[model samples]
Target chain A: MTMKYKDNPQAVADLVRPAEVHRDLYIDDEVFALEMKHLFASTWVYVGHESQVPNAGDYFATDVAAQPILLARHTDGEVYVLHNRCPHKGTKIVIDRTGNTGKFFRCPYHAWSFRTNGKLLAIPLKKGYKDTGFEQSEAGQSGLPPVGAVKNYRGFIFVRMNQEGISFEEFFGGSLSSLDNMVDRSPVGKLEVAGPPLRYMHNCNWKMLVDNQTDTCHPMVAHESSAGTAVEIWESIEKDENTKTPMAMEVIAPFMSPYEFFEDMGIRTWPNGHGHTGVHHSIHSDYSAIPGYLEMMVEAYGEERAKAILGENRHNTVYFPNIMIKGPIQQLRVFIPLAANKTLVESYIFRLVDAPDMLLERTAMYNRLINAPTSIVGHDDLEMYERAQEGLHSQELEWVNVQRLYDADEDLDEEAVENGTTERQMRNQFHAWKKFVVASMEAEARDLTDA
Target chain B: MTLPTRDDLIDFVYHEARVIDEGRFDEWLELWGSDSYYWMPLDYQQDNPKNMTSLMYEDAFLRKLRVERLNGLRTFSQKPKSRCSHVLNRPSIEAFDPKAGQFITRTAVHYVETRLDDQFLLAATVHHHFEMVEDELKIKLKRVDLLNCDAAFGNIQLFI
Candidate 1:
């Protein structure tokens, strides 16, 4: 069924208030379709991390904005994001989650093959379609259709449906510096996706996950069980100093702190719906333990530059429509919108290239503690999102509130500061959403662009 | 060195499964020695437990914390209780070292878990490294290599 929008664009604009959004945005299927076309399709959506397909013939398959895409590293050392469908019969190739294709991808159905880069190689019968007007040499029809536009920012890849507009740096705005801060922390200045990600489908809107990334307000309320459990573990270990490792300290320390601590650390909201929150105290408690890392940074960039690299501790940075960069843990979670109610979250844990084993282990422990299936912290979040989904089904309420610190003034500089408890981040997200959606609608009306 | 007797190892495994299925966590913890390690490696190349991360790398302290939380009345995930069943088959004693008094038993494990209305099954190769201590069988290492170890997952609170 088609959704009927208000005839006036200004009336449609009024649906999103600074402190609240209409509940229809979450439950209406028509609005979801429009969001996929305008918000997801037009904006640069995170595809996958470069470390995922490091070697030739390595391919990672996933869906973005409800479109099936396969990110593959070709034999030529270039990563390509191609449509998963085979051109001949339109069957999906490479059914497995991840595997090395050796040299090329051969469709199991017809045995039609293509290079690891997705260039068509051979067909089953050469003479079958000789007179059928099928042109095999034309790369347009036979080869796998590549994503509209692909760009990589510091090994993190993003794809956009529209070829023109702002560059990825411009699209990311202030969030781009967060990526730089992440990579710079590693002495070698590079990071790779360590292992396969844990894939799960959540029965909630994708926005819930995005919001929760920088939503410091919910940690104390939602994750009380996890925080309590962490404290209990810390107390048990305190009796025996021998068992209290640095890695365990990293995992337990964050959870044991009071909610007021995180609020006092402050938050910074950037344009384009990107923001970060955390106490910028220290990246690592024991930076001196990794002498080799410290030496490399000091040698290449000097001690002052090294200090700046280690000083940034912005916990989680949200990249607008889909991705959340967790700098402390070196983890990234990308949300792929499946439906209004269901979202597929693909998480990747990264290892800092050439860093100390202990450092990597610490980062991995953080990932396991927070993102793992058995995480005490995540259970509360999953429950909350599920409840939010069910609560939105009510016919009585037409709007959802984001009223915390709603009237507070916001900083518009590159490093913008806002009250950590404020709904400023949510407002920023909606402002960006309106800009993209309305711009697309206006562009469509003017040029009659076909998508 | 030769593999352990298939029947004897299968009996041991089935008993262990029963303890977990019946929610006898304290009894389940008794199967391990003081130095026992319960490790679930995150990736294929994870070589050293001290350096690389594992899904569940617990010593006695961490194990105690897990048990305490599981037995805690406040564990919200466990409020309704998660029901689980283990179906063991295709037991293969991959390797054994009698001189070292250790044996490696590999078996295919199909575990299904249900909470409220959610149900999912996991198929994996479970490797149990057992050692003879004081003439009694004790688990040195319990490693589960899941079929989709790298896939995104929801909360995995209990041991598999």
Candidate 2:
């Protein structure tokens, strides 16, 4: 019997097992192509922050699954996600990284113009196409193609490819609460991308980064140099008679210890592959002791609510595939996949909606330590990710194990943990991966059959 | 406080470049005031230092920390050390404040560096905010506005 394209239900099922993942998933080009079509093309990918384009005619350029996309703010106060390709001759509308198009985006090639909202405004030499089937009223060929769907959660924006499946709220599930946890801390309940994001490219696979964000086992090892520096600074400050201790130093000291400190603090893996690791239980003593954070929180929300916001201590919260948010520092890192072995990570530092200047300064300091190229912590992880990419080229291993904490009892029905350093997070990601992949393949098969 | 000659200001630029090129970091540190500021604004429109974020913004304390780390034995990226040569030209004295005993000089600097056979050429606008301290001139601020601040940059091991 001939197997239909969608008939490979068994092959799709094999993608997620309780124990392991196929090695070819990472190394095979064919599998990567399938994933782009199935997973990335179906799920909602984070495009950019709404604060990036705050004014009318403001637009930011980004790429999703190799397709150039533009997120623009219309004059009417609506945000739109549209293809960057110009319909006339298919040239890109905006060539610059980011800028205001004034009233419209004018294509330099043929002088084709488009409204800030991507409506076709004018085409140079209209008489040249008099007999052509081009109609001014036809929305199809005149303007830029709109994305399948655009949704905003708070100030963050996301675009999906399929426009089907679960609603944004349903798809985010409990992870949506993570954004709330971030915004609620702000007195104004709003945050803006404070400055131009720092963009850097790494010579490693994109997945390696997503995995490392919540690994929970690498911080002490990866950041030892930074931790040591922090410790030295802290000690010197303490020894000085006239020096006052800065809260930034206190925030950096706990990270200098052995990995066991983080492992002991444990991890909480939520449903939908979202997870948090490292000191999620206790608030950073340095920050909790600060009167500025306390006063601001109390003023924004009542004392009871202030306590609730201040008490949450999530270190790194992975929003799956693309975004990893660090709540304590108010920094967000967005991962954009360039190729099978290349990734671009953009780091944005946010000033809390009504927080103190010192608070923002501390947050910026954290970003400098962790994400900047001068960072001792950043270099270590970059080296490891590069090594992982090179090592995966070996033809020896056929599967990578995800067996850590496989036997641990679960506090949440969706997660299973055997120990603090379990591989359950990896497994949860694979589960979500398999679902998106299979669903896309099944849709393609149905399209083929209908033809 | 009187304004210094344009020739003297140009000579000061060359002397500053020599201090960095020779890796006289200690002496380089002495060129700046105890409460000196270093800033690299992200955009041209940035006006106030407190409101906008910079690519590199460091007070005296953070600057000392950076220098300490660069000279520290455990700085892995600096294991082999970085060598740089700076070429300065077009020294235009933008403004001078006689009342405050300060001056603002703008110059174009072309900086080239090599570390382990990797080379980088950066063209930037260097702004010197200077003040007189006792008998010597000190830098209150040195802001470098690079043409490609947003591009993919390699490890910035040394001060630019």
Candidate 3:
């Protein structure tokens, strides 16, 4: 409450210790501001996917670290994540969420036209600026600058604005397999956007959504009201032992799985705050095989390779700052931090091209049943998130427990593996949170002390 | 039975909404046909709800499951039970084929769903297709075209 960590990065970093985290990490405005400014800028935040910008001149406008930016395909057949502001006026260039800019992006305010890659092509009224020495200035030539780093890995694009932190490969590390696993499920190892996303707003910190991904322990408890009821209803109906459960029931009932199911499933954490659950099993494991899906994979990758790709059935993969992907189900949700007290979750389902269309239908079903705003299962989680946001305002409490299974973690070279029930995934997340946010403050502190 | 009047069709639509507003799960369930869907499309121009993503495209089983979940004792989100009031414009009779035994109505509705101290209003065009099932008008398809279908929203706790 005293706000000691407002300027003290070390103190802020210390809030995230080995086992527990200070409650301010979720409730503090200064912390959230610092996270937005330093952490998201330096880290790899997912932009729109390459498939979203398939043709040259196509663009998808979004934000990174709260700065407006666009993932655009250039005329040269390359993808760049360029700042979405104009050099002349500083107004955001793209007004629409997604569209083809054709050969150039003409600003709505001024006639300043730019190439799809954000390079200034022409500016009207050049004569007005010539006498003022503005035409030859660096500001005039400077175009919509691309972010520090951009990688279109197998059509899944990611961008880092500052480039101060780890290399993209080093950041994602072994977690890259999750993306690889997702795309490889397609016969041609490609996927496309199914439709527009279902954006859900949550009145809570972005970290709560990120934390919930691998906070595997909450599902059986929080979702009991929703998915648990699905289980109860399914049980009440009598059927043959061999009869497969309805697809609708199959998707919802898994949330009521016993704690031991998740524990045995286990979780793993990578460096730079990335992790996933259901390494060997998840609620997605027993999904009845989609008709003709296996043969499609087999035709593309052959027996062993096809089996390997389909075999990697991970439930949730957290890509550090604000992205969670489900490889097996071909679903992705990104958390956009609007403010310390508000976050927006945009849920997207992908189409595994050439695979059985039913695969995508099931994914759509899963998204609607599990994540939609109208979802029974989703409402329970939303209630928890909102309540947690409200509850954290209490002055009495100062810490949130993250100690479960911490002692039993199997420390590896680049990651820590633990049971899915472990809070170790959260600990790993805060571990990276401290590194990204505190590095800037630490650097500033060093500069000050030297002066 | 005498051929039902157009007013009967209008009354049936009003009754269907009342059951949802009252949290009458059984009554709501009974209003639906055996093969039916409650569709809320994600986009205005969205033509199909089969494979593509939408806000929600729930079939009969999913509709019942949603009701059961809301009624679950452990549904903490409903501890402060959500309530709604539907103010509908007089439904226009889109089609009335008595011999074919099919009827359709289109109404614009302002739906306000509230829980605790927070509330939000949603404007939508409510479209319903009704067919007589065992001498009772049951909903064959209930489609809600929300004014902000594509816009971001919080958890829609109840049907629109």
DockQ of each: 0.41, 0.31, 0.80
| Candidate 1: regions farther than 4 A off | A5-15, A55-58, A74-77, A97-142, A237-246, A282-292, A408-415, A447-451, B1-12, B42-54, B90-98, B132-136, B150-152
Evaluation by TM-score, superior candidate among 1 and 3 = 3
**After superposition, which runs of candidate 3 have C-alpha atoms over 4 Å from their true positions?**
A1-7, A135-138, A240-244, A408-413, A444-451, B1-4, B99-101
Quantify all predictions' global Cα lDDT against the true fold. 0.74, 0.72, 0.86
lDDT of model 3 at residue A117? 80
Every candidate's chain B TM-score: 0.89, 0.90, 0.94
Model 3 residue B88 lDDT?
83
- Give the true-contact fraction for every prediction, in order: 0.40, 0.23, 0.80
Tens-digit lDDT string for candidate 2 (A56-99): 99999988877889999999998888889988677878877788
- Report the first chain's TM-score for all candidates: 0.89, 0.90, 0.95
lDDT of 3 by residue, B108-142 (tens): 99999999999999999988988777777788998
CA-based DockQ, model 1: 0.41
Distance from true position, residue B64, model 1, in Å? 2.3
On lDDT, the candidate that comes out on top is 3
* Interface RMSD, Å, model 2: 2.8
lDDT tens per residue, model 1, A194-305: 7666566678888888878767777656655665665666666545645535455556556555656666767788877888776454223332355477677777668999
Worst 10 residues of 2 chain A by lDDT: A409-418
Off by over 4 Å in 2: A1-32, A121-142, A237-242, A282-285, A288-293, A374-376, A394-420, B1-12, B22-27, B71-74, B79-81, B90-99, B132-136
Model 3, TM vs. native: 0.96
